[model samples]
Target: MSTAHTALIVPPRLGEPLRVVPVEGPDSLKDLLGGDFESVARGDWHLYLNAEGTTGDLPANLRAAQLMHDCGLDLAGAARGPAVILGRDAKGKDTNIPEHLLRRAEELFGTPQAA
Candidate 1:
């Protein structure tokens, strides 16, 4: 079988700067799956389990959760509940925050929040 590759950019911290890691082959797939599939297959059965209830778009969710956590919010609670409450009007429609959460997130992280 032919091998496929993907790049994952890891954010920098206090001491570490940005990092780009190339993942390939089945290892790449494993990294994409976050080391669990069968568990993800199980419904809320793995709700409290890490790497479970995560797949396909998990990487994005994980990144968001991490950012939320870093921004002085409880990620676990958000995962369990709405960590960042999206504003809505009485019409039950989405409304934009004054400064916008994205801008605030950028200010907090010193990096842009994924759109």
Candidate 2:
């Protein structure tokens, strides 16, 4: 899949610049977060953020969560680690964030910048 099928957010650590990285699926998430992952639902979107983020080396993904909230997603709390935002395709398979939502996210949080 193209890089467009990726999540746009800051690095897992605090104070890092935003980035975009491919996210094939939940199985591929273990390689990215270095452990188990979890999916949190926020409206029609699903955020595959790191499961161990609360206790892991990473910090709370406040920036990402805030941007999502601004984009009209019902973000309940600070997301931890790099959060992969996704939507369901026609076949009900997880896919990239919808274009409208992605545009809103970019507008609210700005596009990924150099780190």
Q: Best-fitting candidate, measured by lDDT? A: 2
lDDT tens digits by residue: candidate 1, 1-115: 5432222222322332222233344354345434542311121111112244333333233443564455454445223211122233465432332234344445544543232
Candidate models: Cα lDDT each: 0.33, 0.65
Q: Which ten residues in a row are the worst by lDDT in model 1?
A: 39-48
How well does candidate 1 score on lDDT at residue 45? 12
How would you encode candidate 2's per-residue C-alpha lDDT over 1-114 as one tens digit per residue? 433355654555556656666676556666666678877655556667777777775667777777667766655655777776677566556666666766776676677652
lDDT of prediction 2: 0.65
- In model 1, the Cα lDDT at residue 104 comes to 46
Off by over 4 Å in 1: 1-57, 60-63, 70-73, 77-86, 98-100, 111-115
